[model samples]
Target chain A: MSLFHWLRKKLLFLTRANLFIAIGFMLLLAGWQVLSFYTHEILLASPAQAACALWGIIGTSYFNENFLITLWRLFFGIVSGGLIGFVLGTAAGLNEDIKNILEPFRWIMLSIPPVVVVVLAMLWFGMGSKMVAFITSVLVAPIVYVNTVKGIEMVDEKLVEMARLYKFGFVMRIKDVYTPAIIGPLGAAMVLITCMGARVVILAELMGANDGIGYALGVTRSNLDVPQLFAWVLVTLGIVSVFEFILLRPVEKHFIRWKL
Target chain B: MSPVISFENVVKEYGGRKVISGLSFQIHSREVVGLLGQSGMGKTTILKIIAGLEMPSDGDIKVIAERVGYVFQEPRLLPWRTALENVMLPMIALGMNKKQAGEKANHFLGEMELSEFTHYYPSQLSGGMMQRVSLARAFATEPEVLLLDEPFSALDLQMKDAILSMIEERLLVQPMTVLYVSHSQEEVMRISNRIFMMSSGSKLDELPIQHCRAFRAGCKKAFLKWTKQIGSN
Candidate 1:
């Protein structure tokens, strides 16, 4: 691999595709914003004004407060849900007796909608971080659990036997065999849960919380602050994409190079 | 030489269809034993039983070796790891420190002439290279007994020749005992010191290499004289 070839590989790997898409996105928003001009700009903010408001929102203390609240809830919910899902999923996947016992419950979790879980859970526990986290964790758990169970069930039995012959201990078995095996579906499942978890937290905030991006959006809406609402929406989108690109994508690549 | 592994009256079945019935063998040290049978005759299952992946229905199995290394019919290398990492898998499992495991893996990969491809993943390697990595992984364990399940059935002629000889050199140069399973009589003759013929339902006829080395004995008249006699009866 020469320097030129290396550079070319890097260039191809990280393309201008996202930036161009963003440009096209700005064009679409510009069109939508300009259309608002003819309608007296009642509900929609112009793209330029919205961009200015995006900067304003980021520069203000309100953004920091709301971002922190949403971030904390999502993180807590996902970690808790992922751990529980992993444990229960592995047990169900590996043990026939355990699967028999847990099959009905796991199926029930998979079938129930997150919105329903949130509404009922909010009524039961009240609208707060704990309630939201609990609901989001339930939402995340089934996806993780189902994906994990599906992953383990598809684990190449021949490799398991190979591991046995080598006498692979618990740690080595996970690192050497199971990690790569689980990472594919788990990667997809994590992304799904993260998206759902974030949305659930925002909904939890909108329902009753005093602070969060969702609450800020609600405040801006009632005040007819269209620009600020758009800014808040952009912030949420930024957090979602940034975490996706920065955190999950590379981790997925590291664990599942075959995917690349 | 004392017997280090034994299978007595082993019975194997799948959904009431008996595959190996009353199978028995005593494998001693310092021998490369070939298990030969036609497809679906359960040669692989016998190796699977000895490797402890599957248990016999009603039999006694005694293995005195500290570790048993196996090369599955499939490559079965961890797709995430390099060929070197895959080869050092057993050592890592046995809790050897990273330095020792890596050094051992590097040396064996070098011995197998796979130094250039040490960092390659299973997908990156050719079918032959993948099989060699599997072989290297099995041998790098330093186990007393190696169980191979048709390790070279997938390779082309050139790759097969190179890999089989590479494996032969590694095993022959060390105190490695192998219970190799293969469907090809040619493969059996090239590597095995003893051969076991398995027919339907666990009946075995063990033949020494000197007696059954068809080409070497120039029994061109009856290439598999020993195996045929039993099958015909």
Candidate 2:
């Protein structure tokens, strides 16, 4: 096909979802610009100012050190929490006694405030990355656990019977039946956890740690550098988007691509 | 002929309620048996017990087959797998590698007239098409015994007729002991070598059917009369 014709065909297949997403982003930027106009430069940085400040930090050693530290903490927190929650959730879902036993603990974990956990973790683990990682994992575990249990409960018994009749081994049964059964609910939970994990890690760092993005945000705040603060916020959001879109979304789609 | 499937004094109960009590029957080698029953008459329970999906509360159940293929009331297909992949599942579980299983799955899907829909997922297919995929999955295993529990209820007239003929053709090519459970008298009468009606108290009473491939109008009328008589009681 000619270049123009080929491009037209490809664009024809583009769904309205991307267009709507672009519109949403445009609206956000417009709102940010309007808000910045009404506030002092020291209070609210315009998008352009924030972009320029972000450009300034792009290759700085301070930015690299803090960004990598925060990224590692976020990574470790989510992985550890997700793994622990999946194992416990599967146990609780499969056995009534286990579910009953875990009920009060689940309630406590879900209901306890993030601030209280951060304070308690600070007391227990002291400051720095350890405290931040602990707080992130503590806040994230209940979300994944609850969703996993719900997903397991919703699994179709007919499909399980079919698997048994076909003599599916343990690994095949989990791969074919359980994993797909849980992926839908778990996908939504992962997105929630990703966004929440980013916020919690930054918050914990702000509260108890002397390093990472939250500490840098605190530094910019003390210096009255609103552009730098906004830049840090943008970088945090960017990190969340990268993990959500690049890592979690593709894995979830691979598992449940049969869905329309 | 030696019985391939024999259940002696089989009893099953769920939560203090008895579903099957002292049910005894024998299905000989290559004999296609049709089980007719109302909803919740333990017809499915009987099939489950034979397939080893459920245990009899009290009895000896023996199935000579090394493998058993089942088609449930619903398609019960893995929603994430395509039509071809769903059919390939049992063959792969039975130790056939991917390539061989894919070829066999293709052959069965072709037999069900689902060649074009091999890559279509369950959600993408219609109700009848999904059921056809389930049928293809069952037949692809080439099991020595096949259990079909109201598998055709979800299918329309044309699809049901085509599938019934496909089952008949498969039986002709390679005889396997089949227990076809359904509420449709015509369906049971069409394919069954021996027909059994679920009577009161979880018991089965053999009902004679006209042994003809064409299934004339008179035989259908007689079968309907018998069904009504049994149904009313």
Most accurate candidate by DockQ: 2
Clashes of each: 0, 0
Write one digit per residue (lDDT tens) for candidate 2, span A95-165: 88999999999999999989999999999999998889888988888899999899888899889889999
Instruction: Note the residue pairs that clash in candidate 1.
Output: none
DockQ of 2: 0.75
DockQ of candidate 1 (2 decimals):
0.70
- lDDT value for model 1: 0.82
**Top lDDT prediction, candidate number:** 2
Stretches of model 2 off by over 4 angstroms after superposition: A1-27, B208-233
lDDT (Cα, tens digit) per residue for candidate 2, span B138-215: 888888999999998877888889889989998999799999999887888788979888975457877764533334
Best by TM-score: 1
Give the range of the ten consecutive residues with the poorest summed lDDT in model 1 chain A: A13-22
- Candidate 1, residue B167: how far the Cα is off, in Å: 3.0
On the 0 to 100 scale, the lDDT of residue A153 in model 1 is 90
Candidate 1: where are CA atoms >4 Å away?
Answer: A1-27, A34-40, A113-116, A119-127, B208-210, B217-219
